[model samples]
Target: MESTMQLLNKALSVQRAAAWVEDMNLSKSAISMAQKRGRLSPVLAGNLAIKLGENPEHWIAVAALEAEPESELLTRLRKAANSWRKL
Candidate 1:
């Protein structure tokens, strides 16, 4: 699964990402922060997924998974997300 930052980078150029951040009412540094950290907040991830015409819940799960340390639940959630994507 791609990280939320990766997804956003693939979908938007630097200028467009800035514009999107502004449009979303996020701080000017929001995208930059996410890029530096290599992840986005779950809310932002879901909203970006919506903007990209994807399932918000799936991307939100992706974001949440990225934020967590590896564990059994994380493994299960990743499997679930992958299965959902197949549907």
Candidate 2:
């Protein structure tokens, strides 16, 4: 049987997560672009939280997602979405 985390993984693939970022008017490539290039914008990051049924207000550093932040103020808000976390 699949472990709880494994089952969850199936529902949220890299593509799925990328699509989530794209839905916020960003690139699907943000997933890798964040690491290769830089961090993501605050709006995109916050929208990502909502896509995952999370609260942006309490959002933590997810560690595997990104988008070009819209402003300098949001530059510090760039953090991964935890897609990098695995056992």
Candidate 3:
């Protein structure tokens, strides 16, 4: 499980965090908790994937099978999303 702070750090864009908040049905605080010892559901994962420019359905499928998240998975997701944006 990722800490809220970690997720927040990983969120390269406020748009990413805002999108997560909206889709997860979570308040910023709740997202914070989720980041700290909380699991990101397939829906949430799909939302992030969508934000990253991947097909939501494609990630949703991956989310279904890959319920548990680790550093490796999260890293892959993060890279796939490429949260970084040049201003």
**lDDT of each structure?**
0.80, 0.42, 0.52
The CA-based lDDT of model 3 is what? Answer: 0.52
Query: Residue 71: error of model 1 in Å?
Result: 3.4
Clashing pairs in 1: none
lDDT of the structure predicted as candidate 2:
0.42
Let me know the TM-score candidate 3 reaches against the reference structure: 0.40
- Show the lowest summed lDDT stretch of 10 residues, model 3: 1-10
By TM-score, the better pick of 2 and 3 is 3
- Looking at model 2, which ten-residue stretch has the lowest summed lDDT? 1-10
| Full candidate order by TM-score, most accurate first | 1, 3, 2
Question: What TM-score do all the candidates reach, one by one?
Answer: 0.77, 0.38, 0.40
- Judging by lDDT, tell me the better candidate of 1 and 2: 1
Alpha-carbon runs more than 4 Å astray in model 2: 1-18, 37-40, 60-87
Off by over 4 Å in 1: 76-81
Tens-place lDDT digits, model 3, residues 1-87: 122233334543555656767765777765555466444556665566666665556555454534554668766765664432111
Candidate 2 per-residue C-alpha lDDT over 1-87 given as tens digits, one digit per residue, 9 for 90 to 100: 112222224325534755655556656675455445434345544455566665544333332222333665445443332233331
Top lDDT hit: 1
